[model samples]
Target: MIIAEQKPIQEIKAMIAGYQKVLIVGCDTCVTICMAGGRKEVGIIASCLRMALQIDRKKPQLIEDCIQRQCEWEFVDTLKDKVDGVDAILSSACGVGVQALAERFPNKPVYPALNTTFMGMPNEHGLWVENCRGCGNCGLGRFGGICPIARCSKGLLNGPCGGSQNGKCEVSKEMDCGWQLIYGRLKTLNQLDQLEDILLPKDWSTDRDKGQRKMFRGDVYYEQTV
Candidate 1:
């Protein structure tokens, strides 16, 4: 999932302070699972903003709402009624969601409440780890599912950098050598012979270096409503 963390309250307050009315919008998808932009977080942020404004003798209206998602226009359209009453929108979704809102409501100013961290999953309770770089080219078939591009400190494709000690990456003791993990996994699978295969230099052009990428689906089409 897309992982993100909420921005500091002070920063959020400063962004909406100039507006007479603000709406705090939450996303019930990725941010919710990370506990950053869920319904409960929206309420907490809204209440805190109200209290802070009251102390400063400011009377700006504050409202909170959470939608199923902010990335899709269908879910964002549900905010038409609530957004009409607010001067600005504070989006507690990921960067994608913030941009979606900005595109949908060109006249209104949109502010992000969270920093989009990475595409990852929870390793344990409250602990998330980066797994994939989404480089557009996937080589997991040769690496036994461990991503060398993201997990390796130097993004090595062939093997460990020869600097690993006791399976720990040379860059940090806390980090496991990604290649070492791959070797161990492949060894267990009895596919260590594949390691002898020579790999060509990775084609980085398919990655973010090329710029924003997109996918099109020919099977799905939109239906017009009269």
Candidate 2:
């Protein structure tokens, strides 16, 4: 899932400082699951903004609304009524969601109230760790399901680096070596022989370097631009 965190209140206030009316939009998909830009968060931010504006004697009008998802056009289209007569929009969704709104409503000024952190999941209750970089090229099968490109500090495609010591990375004593985890996983599955295979240098052409990648679906007869 795409993990994000809400921006600080001061920064958000500054973003919409001159706006007399603003709409706070929330996304209910990935940002919601990460507890960042859900309906509840939208309400909280709206309330705080309202109070802050009131203290400044701005008499600002604030609207709070949450959609199923801000990334999809269908979900974003539902905000037609809520966005009416709004001077600006404060999106509590990730960066993608903010851009989606901006694309959908070109005339309206849209601002992000959250910072897109990473594509990862929560390890425990409140700890989220990045697992994937979405490099577009997937090579997890050869690495015992562990992604060296993301987990490894050096992003090594082959084996552990010389700096790895006793399953810990030299960059940080608390960080686990990505290759060490892969080795253990391969050993458990009796696939340690796969380690001897030499992996060529990664082809980064499949990554975001090409700019604005798209995936086409013949069955659906649609193209998804990411």
Candidate 3:
């Protein structure tokens, strides 16, 4: 899932300064699981913003709403009525959702209230760690399911750097050595021999370097411009 952090109140304050009627839109899916832009969070932010704006002697009407998602066109299209009544939108969704609103509405000013952090999952309560870079390629089989490109401090493809000691990376004692985890996983699977195999240089063209990635369906005449 895509993890996001909510922007501070002061920054959001400056966004809707001139707009009299502002809508605080939340995404109920990815941002919800990450505890940043859910319906509950939307209410919390709206209350905070209301207080902040009131103190400034600028009382803007805040309308709070949460949709199933703010990324897909189908989900975003549902906000047409609410958006028509607002001067600006303070989106609790990620940057993609903000852009979707900007493109869909074309005239309304949409501001992002959350910073899109990364594609990761929660490791513990209130703690989310990045696990994948979404490089558009999968090489987990050779590394026993651990991704050296993302987990490794140096992004080493072959083996652990000499900088590691006692399962902890030299980068920090709190950080686990990526290769150490891989070695343990491979040992458990009886695939330690796979470590000897050299992996070729990663093909990064499959990544976001090319710009404007898209997905489509051959069975249907539709393309998703992501």
Candidate 4:
């Protein structure tokens, strides 16, 4: 899931202070699971902002609302009615959601209330760890499901750096060596022999440097809609 954390209250205040009415939009998908941008968080932020604004002798005309997703135009369209009333929009979703809102409502000032961190999974109750870099090409098959590109500190594809000691990454004592984890996982699967296979170089064409990427399935998409 896409992981994100809310921006500081002071920063949020500065962004919406100029506007008379602001709408806070929350996402019910990725950000909700990670406890960042959700219905609960929307209320929390709204209440906090109201109090903060009160201290500044400003009347808070903040409107709190949530949608299924802020990334999809279908979900974003729900905001059309709400958008007509607000002067500014503060999105509590990830960076993508913020951009979706901006693209959908170009006239309104769309402000991101969270810093989109990474594509990660929940490690614990409130902890999230980066798992994949979404490098466009997937090579998890060779590494026993452990992605060396994302787990490795240096994004090593072949093996652990020689700097790893006691299964800990040389970069940090608390961090596990990604390659070491891969070796152990492969050993457990009794497929350690695959380690001898040389992996191909990363396909940079699908990389972010390649520019805005889009995917379509003709089976589910209609040409007329696009």
* Alpha-carbon lDDT, every model: 0.92, 0.92, 0.92, 0.93
113-200: candidate 4 lDDT, tens digit per residue: 8989999999999989999998888889989999998899999877887888999998999999999999999999999999998877
Please tell me which predicted candidate would have the highest TM-score against the true structure: 4
Candidate 2 residues lying further than 4 Å off, grouped into runs, are 222-226
Residue lDDT tens for model 1, 130-199? 9999999999999998999999999988888889899999898999999999999999999999889989
lDDT for model 1 comes to 0.92
How far is each candidate from the true structure, as Cα RMSD in Å? 1.7, 2.5, 2.3, 1.4
TM-score for each model: 0.94, 0.94, 0.95, 0.96
Number of clashing residue pairs in every model? 0, 0, 0, 0
**1 against 3, candidate with superior TM-score:** 3
Residues 3-75 of candidate 3: C-alpha lDDT, one tens digit per residue = 9999999998998888999999999999999999999999999999999999999898999999998999899
Whole-model lDDT, model 2 = 0.92
CA shift of 37, model 2, Å: 0.7
Error of 2 at 170 (Å): 2.5
Q: Give candidate 3 regions above 4 Å deviation.
A: 223-226
Q: Give a tens-digit lDDT track for model 2, residues 167-192.
A: 99999998999999999999999999
Compared with the true structure, the alpha-carbon lDDT of candidate 4 equals: 0.93
